[model samples]
Target: AQTVTQSQPEMSVQEAETVTLSCTYDTSESDYYLFWYKQPPSRQMILVIRQEAYKQQNATENRFSVNFQKAAKSFSLKISDSQLGDAAMYFCAYRGFYGGSQGNLIFGKGTKLSVKP
Candidate 1:
């Protein structure tokens, strides 16, 4: 069984500043994928970034990057140059990549991020 956990229920970041959201997961499978998705007020799940369990390097997308520690089963998101539009409900998700997998995404409860000007 795999589960994602976001210890912080909410986070705040000043405009133009940076914030890091923590996420951890427990999975016995060696091959899998981790992702960060942002759902804004409009209720759209936007893909922030993703990391392959086999990849040693962390994944980055523009101002959003992830610190992926495979051995520790930790994947955290760092948002740089935070803007008002960055405010949203961020979720940490996990997916099994092996064969016969259901391809279901296990998501965390989510961390609500608010940007302050």
Candidate 2:
């Protein structure tokens, strides 16, 4: 069984600053994918970034990057140069590369982010 955990229920950041959102997971499988998804008030799950378990380098997408600690099972998201549009509910998810339900994503409870001017 796999589970994702987002300890912070909510976080706030200034419009031009940077913020890091914490996330951790427990899993027995060796091959999998870790993702950070953002859902704005509209409730659409958008993939922010993803990291493969076997990849040593963390995944990055423009201003969005991940700090993937494989040995400790920690995957945190870093939002650089935060903007008002980045305010949303962020979820950390996991999907095994091989399993009975390979494509099913196990999601965290989510951390709501608010941007302050």
Candidate 3:
């Protein structure tokens, strides 16, 4: 069984500042993918970043980056220079590259991030 957990239900970050959202997962499989997804009030699930389990380097996209600790089963997202547009519900997710549930994504409850100016 694989599961993702977001310890924080909500987070706040001041404009132009940085914020980190914590996520941890339990997975017995070694070949998998970890992702951070953002869903705004508009209800769109945007892919913030992704990391392959076999990769040693953390994944990054623009203002978003991840601190991936494979051995610890921890994957955290760091948002730099926060903006109002960054306010949204962020979800930590996982998917096995090969397995019965390979086509499905297991997601966390989500962390609502509020950006304050």
Local lDDT at 58 for model 3: 89
Clashes of 1: 0
TM per candidate: 0.96, 0.97, 0.97
What's the CA error at residue 65 for candidate 2, in Å?
Answer: 0.4
Candidate 2 lDDT tens digits, 50-87: 99999999999999999999999999999999999999
Candidate 1 Cα errors over 4 Å, as ranges:
99-102
Local distance difference test, each candidate: 0.95, 0.95, 0.95
Name the TM-score of candidate 2. 0.97
Task: Mark the regions of model 2 whose C-alpha exceeds 4 Å error after superposition.
Answer: none
Residue-wise lDDT of candidate 3 within 49-101, one digit each (tens)?
99999999988899999999999999999999999999999999999988675
Question: Which ten-residue region of model 2 has the weakest summed lDDT?
Answer: 96-105
Scored against the true structure, residue 76 in model 1 reaches a CA lDDT of 97
RMSD of each: 1.0, 0.9, 0.8
True-structure Cα RMSD, model 3: 0.8
- CA shift of 99, model 2, Å: 3.8
Candidate 2 collision pairs: none
